[model samples]
Target chain A: MALDKSLVSGSMTMLILKLISERDMYGYEMIDTLRQRSNHSFELKAGTLYPILHGLEEKGMVRSYDKEFAGKTRKYYSITSSGMAQLEERTKEWKEYSDAVRGVLALEVSVL
Target chain B: MMEEYIRILLEQIRCKKSHKYIESEIRSHIEDQIEENMSRGMDPETAERMAVNSMGDPVMTGTELDMIHRPQMNIKLIVMIAAISIIGVLIHSLMLHDSFLQPETEMISGHYLRDVIIGLCVMTGICFVDYSVIARFSKLIGGAIIALKILLIVKSLIEVNSAVKWIGYGGIWMSWLLFDMIYIPIFGAIVYKNSRQGRKGLIKSFMWMYIPVFLELLSANMTCALIMLISMTAQMYLAIRKGWFGESYKAAITALVSGDVATPSIAASVVKAFGSVFPTNTFNLYRDIVAGFIANDERNYITGMLRTINKAALLFGDSSSELSNSMPAADNQYMLTYINCHYGIMVGIAVCLLIGWSLFYMFRSLIKQNNQLGLIVGTGCLMIFILNLALNILINLGAFPIMECWIPFISAGGSCIVLSYALTGILLSIYRYKNVYPSDVDVKMPKLKLLLEQ
Candidate 1:
C-alpha cells in the first residue's frame, strides 16, 4: 500500500513499474499495494489494472517470473528499464499535475 | 492473500458470464486493496476482505464497468459504418460491374455506404431492442423466415451470372442482401424462450427453425440456409441445456422423414402429389408406398419445380466475386484466410487454443452441475460457430481467398461485428451485472439447469 500518489493517480502504470522498480510482485500483489496506498480512496479494480499490467508486460515494460514463495508459487513482476523510464516520466507529469491542481485549489476565492 | 482472493474470484466468475475482460479487472482491484491494507499493517486476511469490499459488489460493478469500457461508442460506430459501408458498396459495384465499372471511386464508395447502412440497421435492431418484444411476433417472425427462404426460389428462377444470388430489387440484382439473417437470431430466441417449458414445447419451438431451413434448402439457397440451420441448431442445443429443449428437433426430423413440411393442410397435399407420381420413382420408393398415409406440402413440390431452373444456377453460380470465373464450384470461409494472412496460421491456431482453454475453464464450473441440456446447448453453439467458420474458410479457399466469412470481433464490418459482440455483452450483463441466474429479482428463483452441479 505504500505507493506515491503523484505516481499512482496520474498513471498508476508507473506505480506498477515502481512496484516492480524494486522487486517483482505478481498481479494480485501489485493491485493490493495500489488500493491500500490510496487509503480506499482509489480502489484499483481488476478491470483497470490487469489491462495496464498486460499492456506493460506486452510492451516489455515489466517482466514476470514465477517462483515458489511461502507455500504457493506465484508469478512475480519486475520493472524493466523501459518501465522505470516510463515511471520516471509519469512521476514528473504527476508532480506537475498535482502542483497545477494545488495552485488552482490554492487560489483565494473571493466570496461574492 | 490477494492471490487467494483472485483464485476464489475466478471461481465466482461462473461459466454463463462473459469473463474475458473483467477477470483481469477483478484481480487488479483485489491486489490494489490488499497492498493498501498490508502497508497499513493489516494482516493478509483483513487486507483481502478490505480489497474485496472496496470492489463494491462485483456484480453491479462489473456491469457498470462493461458499459463504460466495452466497444459501443459512437466514434467506434462511425468507424465501423465507414468501413462496412465501403465493403458493401464494393460488393454492390462488383455485382453490377459488368453493367458499368464507372472508373470513379467516390460514386462507388457512396453505394457501399448504403449497403453498410442496411446491414448495420438490421444488426442494431437485433442487438439493442428487447429480444422479448421481437419474440411476441413469433408467428410472424417464423413466417418471415420461411418467406425469405422462398426468395431463393425467386433468385433461382430469375437468376443471372450463373448464381442464384439476387432478387429483383426493382431493376437491380441485389446479391447477399441477407434478410434471412433475422431468421436464425429471431428463431433462436423464440425457440429458447418458448421451449422454456416442456419437451413438446421445446420440439415445437425447434420446428419454428426447421421449417424455414427445409424451405430454404428446397429453394436452393442452401448456403445461407445451412448457416442459419447450423447456428440455430447450435442455439437450440444450448436451449436444451437451459432445460428448454423441446421436441423441436424430433418434430423437424419427423416432418422431413414423413414428407410433411408445413401446416397439416399443406402436408396432406404435398404427400399426395409426390405419392401419386412415383409409382416407378427410384428414390423414396418406400416413402411413396406409405406416402398415402404420411403427409407433405406443395411448398417442396413448388420449390422442386423452381429448382429445375435453379439447378442450372447451382451448376454455375459465383456468390462472392462478380466475375464469371472469380469463384470455384465451391466457396470456403473468408474469416480464416484473413486471420491466417494477418496473424499467420500458427498464431491463429494459438489464439484459438487460448480462447478454447479459457472457454474450457469457463464451462468447467457450469458443467460441475448436472444440467446436461445447458452444457449441450452451450457447447453446441461453440461448435456451430467453429464449424461455420471452418466451412466458410474452406469455401473461400476453394474459390476466392478474399471471402465474406466474418471475424466475430476482429472483422471491420461494424454491423456484423456488433452483432456478435452483443452476445458477449449479454452474458456479461447477465452473469457479472445481474449476478448468477437471470432472475426475476423479486421472486424466489428457480435453479436453471447447469452442467456442473444439480
Candidate 2:
C-alpha cells in the first residue's frame, strides 16, 4: 500500500469526495473511516489529514459548516460541485490506469 | 439483532480522548466492531471489552488524540499596560506634593513628577525580578507582610497617629507611612503569587493578603479595610475566570471568618471606624477601655481624634476653629459629607475613580491572555484601588486632612511614591527580561531570590 503511493492518495481523495457528496464530514471522522476501510493500512495522522482537508476547503473542493450537536460544536466539510467534477475525472483516470495494468498482466500466451 | 453488542461498544470509550472528534470516531468504530463480533455470536460484554482492547489504551490514545488550546498575544494589550501604570503613577504624585518651600503650585507639580520617577523605578523592579523565585518562596514573602502589619498595629497605639501606616518603633503604630509600605509587598505578593493560580496557591496568597489590612483596619482605619476587601474580590474574579482556581469553583471560596469580629465590642470600634486605624497593640493602651466600653463612654474617642487634628493644624499653622477638631458625631462612612470643607475630597474621589478604572482596565488588558502576570498585578492594583475608595469616602474635607493611608504612587510624598515606583519598576523589569515569564522555570527563581534578597 505504501509503494502504491498514487493509488493510496487517489483512493483517499475519492473516499472524501464520496462521503462529502452525500454529507459534510469532519476531518477526524473522514480519516477514521478511510483507515477502517483500509484495515489500518493508511494511518492518516491528524497532523497530515487536517492540512489536506483545509487545503481542499480553501481550493473550493469542499464547503464547511461550523455547527453544534449534543452541546458540543464541530466544523464539518462537504464536497462542492467542483469537487464532484474532479472526482468524476479522477475515477475515469483510475479505471483506465488499472485496466492498462491488468491488460499488461493478462497478455495472451500465443506461444502456448 | 445486536442491541446488546451496541451497549457494549458504548462502554469501550471511557474518556481517553481529549479531542471531541476523535472520541466519537473511536466510540462509533468500537460500536461497529462490537456488532461484527456479535454477528459471530460473541456476548455483548466480552465484545465491548475486546473492542476497547483493539482500539488501544485510553490514556495514551487520548493524549495523542486531542488538540491543544493555544491563545495568542495581541497589541492593544501591551499599550494599555504601559499607559495605565505610567499615567496612574503621574496622577497619584500630585496628591503627595509637599508644600514646604516652593510655591504651592510648583510643589504639587514637582511632587507629581517625583511620583512618576518612583513609579518607573517600581515598574522596572517588578518587571525584572524573577517572579518564579517570588512564587517559589511566596510563603516567606506572605509571612513577612503579615508580620509587618502586626508590628504596625502595635506601634500605632504608642504614637497615636504620626502617620505610622509606614513606620514603627517600639509597640506603637504611629508611623502610618511605614505601615503602608508593607502593602506594596503584600498586594505585590498577591499579584506575584495569585497570578500563579492554584487553590492552594491563592489561599496561600490570601493569608498574606489580609494580615496587614486586618491590622491596619484594627488600627482604626476604615479605608484600608475596604481596600483590602476589594483587592481580594477582584483577584478572585479574575483568578476564577482564568480557570486558575482548580477545576471546581467550590474550593476557590472559603469561610470568611474574621478573628476580631468574634471579639467583644468596645467604644474603640467607633474610634476604629471613624479614626480609621486599628491600634498596633491588641492590648489596651489606656487602662479604662473595658470600663469605658461598659459605661458607653466613646466621647473620649472623638476627643482623642480632635486632639490629633488640632495638633496637625497647629503644626501646619491653620486658623483655629472648634468644629475643626470634631465631626458631626455621625457613625457612618460618609463622615465628611456634612463638613463640606475638604472640597478637594470631591475632586480627589472623582479623579481617583477615573484614574483607578483606567489603570485597572489597562492592567487587565496587559495581562488579558496572560493569567500569571495579569492575575498578580490585576489583583494588586485592585486591592490598592479598594484602599483608595475607602479613603476617598471617609476622608474629612474643608482643609487638608493628613492622610494616614498610602496610595502607591500618589497621596503621600517622599519615599512613599518613589519607593512604590521602584518596586513596580523592578517587577516590570523582571517580567521583561525573564524567559517563559509565567512559568516556574527553575532557571529564573534563583535570580529572583538573589534580587529580592538584596
Compose the digit string of candidate 1's lDDT tens values, residues B247-364. 4556544543343325333533543455333233212533432342232433223223222222222222232223222211111123333233323455445444544443344344
Error of 2 at B308 (Å): 25
In the range B1-454, model 2's lDDT, one tens digit per residue, is 2333323433343432212333343445566667766888999988877655555444443332222211123234335445644654454343234222234434544556555665565555565454444555655665665676666555555665545445545773233443454354345445445544565666655556555555554554544454555555565555555565453654554322332232213334544444433334433432333333332355335434533443344212233444443543221222233112223334345445655664465454434222244345435644564565455443433122333444444443455455545544433433342222221222223566777989
For the predicted complex of model 2, DockQ is 0.03
Interface RMSD, candidates in the order listed: 12.1, 11.5
Candidate 2: count of backbone clashes, pairs at least 3 residues apart or interchain: 73
Q: Which candidate is the best by DockQ?
A: 1
- Provide DockQ values for all models, in the order shown: 0.04, 0.03
TM-score, chain A only, candidate 2, equals 0.79
Q: Indicate the DockQ of the complex predicted as candidate 1.
A: 0.04
Error of 1 at B360 (Å): 10
